[model samples]
Target: MQESHSNESQIQIRLVTKQSEYAVPDIPLSVPANIETAGLNELLNHLLKENKPDFLKQKQFDFLASGELVRVSLIEHLQERSVSVETTVEVEYIQVTPAPQPEDSILHEDWVAAIETANRWMLIGCYDHSVSIRTPHGKPVTSSKEHKNIVKDVAWVDQQQPSKGLVSVSHDLTGILWAWEEGTDKIEPRVKLRGHERGIDTVAVSPNSNRLATGGWDTNLKIWSASLDGDDNGEPASKKKKGPSDISTRTPIHTLNGHKECISSINWTNNHVLYSASMDHTIKFWDAELCGIKNEIVDQKAFLSSSWSALSNTLLASSADRHIRLYDPRSTEGSVCKVMFTSHTLWVSSVAWSKYSEHLFLSGSYDSTVKMWDTRSPKAPLYNLQGHEGQVLVVDWSNSKYLVSGGTDNYIHIFKNKQIFK
Candidate 1:
């Protein structure tokens, strides 16, 4: 009799959802107080199964109690939030993102240090002192062994052009501009950017494709004017091999100085606004048109990488402290960090925001893993990707259908799944 009474203990709860197909009655439900996430999942499934007998496959759900994910027992969650169990508790439900399937793994001759993808092409930089343009299937399109040292970064200056323009920076302290048509097998070097005193670590192209931003170990950011109009004629630079005397050299039109240490990454939100991350533990928002620093976000740990998300209107930074953080650049109260993801065991080297979803983002870490995260669920990651044999150096989500990552393992890992979107 005592066991029966113990099992009879219950709490009053109300289930809700924005999805009309999974809607249940709006009335309060009396459920076991000790029911955990698994038990509630099973109960919800049973309720839906009875209403629609055709629902044969049990669907998984994430429950939210008091606007937060319910990771504990029903009563425990209420208690922690200081909610009274006697009153009807409102709980929300949403479907979880399916585990992304492994799509492909492309092998490289050297460590793949950087990656950028477009609708028709993919660009990669390697430690082998080469930059290559390849198809989505990993077929080599064109490559350049022009950089004297390891290629640290690469960017597509114009993605819409049939003849694409690109910029590459290297540890050799130089940045090169190249123009190549889609079907061509040769990467023609156009301009040599010479100014940085030390290794150039990162490069970013403006949205208009008329300017380039290069940051380096010298703790300086340099802007250069890029004009690929001269190469628009039918004559391809690939038709003839160009020597050192053939290419013209140019220096930065404007140099922005603020960071105290190596500038690790750069991103342009628009043609005039720029953001830069540095090893000195700061992210500076710049007015590129005026060549001035408008504001800065200070942190405790050195940042390794940074990205700007126009969808979320926030700035993301990967740090030496092994975490990915998001800060609102519009915040006037000292640009406080709004969210922090702390799943990676080692330093997070890179982070890329999804172009399609405001909530989805990717992170690569020295722990040799890449994790898919959603802003809604801060306590845990949506999925953990493990394909790299060594520290993951970069990740890219420029294409909506695929998430790409590369690392010291000398390979590019692709993850894809149709069910990733609601």
Candidate 2:
């Protein structure tokens, strides 16, 4: 033990480990206030050698203070946590667990274009012109009938009914609504929506479940009523009673025409705010309440997919240039990307933020891999998940525990990490 000077402050540190037999001293150790974490780690390794010489060489350890990993220098961390020399800090030594591998793979018949999770069900839209709903355990629940062309995207309606509803858009130039019947594998087509002049690329259901938005190759974003009782203007049909006849006849309430190229993706952050990405190399933020574009972000590279962070004002867009750009809509700079993550060797086709983590996100690319990124470290992905044999088109973080990726190889890969859940 080093002697402390009169001017040097002292802090008591207690080492806690997972092993029951690896007993640390009952009393805390007095250490200099300005000691760095690396110095502390070195001291701990030396102390461990007396009782367990091989432990230090066989396993790696992570230091945690108050449940947060101690990544910064000790002095910096102390200042950030307001830890004075008079306070005793509890430092925990935890073994660094390896990332979990893919637990299972579900094979598909065609390329998966979109994926969404709700409750216990996982929905997938495939190039086979159909949408499938399955269990996270890879059990197929039901699938929709094939459309005229490949299915582009799928959205689940936030309905109160146990038999939830879903809407899907397709290259068939139409959107179809399906209703799942309880206790059965049957998914019945409730409505067929048609208005776009070309294939519809993506569809999103508003948070309130009252409105639906669809973007199409015709460079138009259209808003429609989620209910089957209304007309183009959202007024009830002239007939006294509504039936299946009124479903397919409904039109869009608004058609937002601004993009010079095909719309690739659509995301509804809230009931009133919608974000649309286009091949025109731009992203437009639309105010659904005012029926107008509130903001626009122009980029040199075309955007293939976009997703809003559920935990922050941040937005992520996967570009045709094979990069994922993070944007802060609240920034004064118009659409200036805050961070660029560029490990993907091919076009990034999809990006999804973890619903449970504010800064963690997942991206899939045409390079046939899914990369997990933490905004705190943008230079490299936290994990590069490689299993897909073809272009990975879509990825989803399911319940913050399972990571699912779908690709042109007609396979759905699921990954799990115990550390991620912690």
lDDT of candidates 1 onward, in order:
0.84, 0.79
User: On a 0 to 100 scale, what is the lDDT of residue 252 in model 2?
Assistant: 81
Q: Give the per-residue lDDT of model 2 (tens digit) for 1-422.
A: 22342337667887887655555564588776667657777777767776675565744555666555566655556666666545667887755545647877998888888887766777889998888888777889898665889998887786334365888899998888777775368777767787999999999888778889999789999998876334655466566765533344557878898999989988888889998999999999999878899999998999999888768878999898988999887798654688888899999999989877776789999999899887755667868987999999889874566788898999998887566533
For candidate 2, the per-residue lDDT at 266 reads 87
- As a TM-score, model 1 comes out at 0.87
The runs of at least 3 residues in candidate 1 whose Cα sits more than 4 Å from the true structure, single-residue gaps closed, are 1-9, 19-27, 46-57, 78-87, 160-162, 230-245, 332-335, 420-422
TM-score of each: 0.87, 0.77
Candidate 1's residue-wise lDDT over 1-422, tens digit each? 12332556888889999888888776798898878889888988988998887788988998888776787777777777788776888989887667778888999999999999877788999999998988777778989899999999998888666375888899999998887777678678887888999999999988888888999899999988766533322124355666733665777888999889999999998899988999999899899888888888889999999888878788789999988888897876754798888899999999999887777889999899999988766778889987898999999988777889999989999888556454
- What's the CA error at residue 221 for candidate 2, in Å? 0.5
Q: How accurate is candidate 2 locally (lDDT)?
A: 0.79
